[model samples]
Target: MKNLTDMMKQARELQSKLAAAQEELEKLEIEGSSGGGLVRVTLTGKGAMTAVKIDPSLFNPDEAEILEDLITAAHNDAKTKAETVVGEKMKSLTGGLPLPPGLNLG
Candidate 1:
């Protein structure tokens, strides 16, 4: 009974820490760029897009498709970075506890 009680306490503490970690993640921002820095995107650790930047040189109407591709690349880059940040934070929060495969946080 004592061991079970202690386990419950630890579970509650972990839950609290996980919630705090998620809140902290919302405050983090990561930047990613593509097309040799012609395009850039910023994303929060929670995977929300915060901003986008594009070089003025890529504004040609004839290159709309290229611009679109660059934007996609930059957004993907930002998303990947955000995921990595969240993963690292979760790892720290869980004390390296192994999460089941395919169970993404977001």
Candidate 2:
């Protein structure tokens, strides 16, 4: 039927768009910071951490726990940002329709 043929064509186009978006995400970088900007994290759009920055003043042997906590916070921030970016990108590609909850793109 013509309708089935059209549906198949649309599916192929959507698949192409998703593949292109995935490639773009691999090349995109998102940054997030915390601890009054004393810590920063950079991650790829695919949620891989690429770099971490910590304020020199935070380096104290007696207070290493604080530094660890800050690093964790920064990483989480970066991850959340990456998810938001991916979600926005997917939304655009899907004509504003959000993917199902808990759907893992990776």
Alpha-carbon lDDT of model 2: 0.90
Write the residue-wise lDDT of candidate 1 on 2-104 in tens digits: 9999999999998898888878888888999999999999988888888999999999999999999999999999999888878888888788999889966
lDDT of 1: 0.89
Question: Candidate 2's error at 55, in angstroms?
Answer: 1.7
Give the best candidate by lDDT. Answer: 2
Q: Rate the local accuracy (lDDT) of all candidates.
A: 0.89, 0.90
User: Which residue segments of model 2 deviate by more than 4 Å?
Assistant: 98-102
- In model 1, the runs with Cα more than 4 Å from the true position are 100-103
Q: For model 1, name the residue pairs that clash.
A: none
Give lDDT: candidate 2, residue 24: 94
TM-score of each: 0.91, 0.90
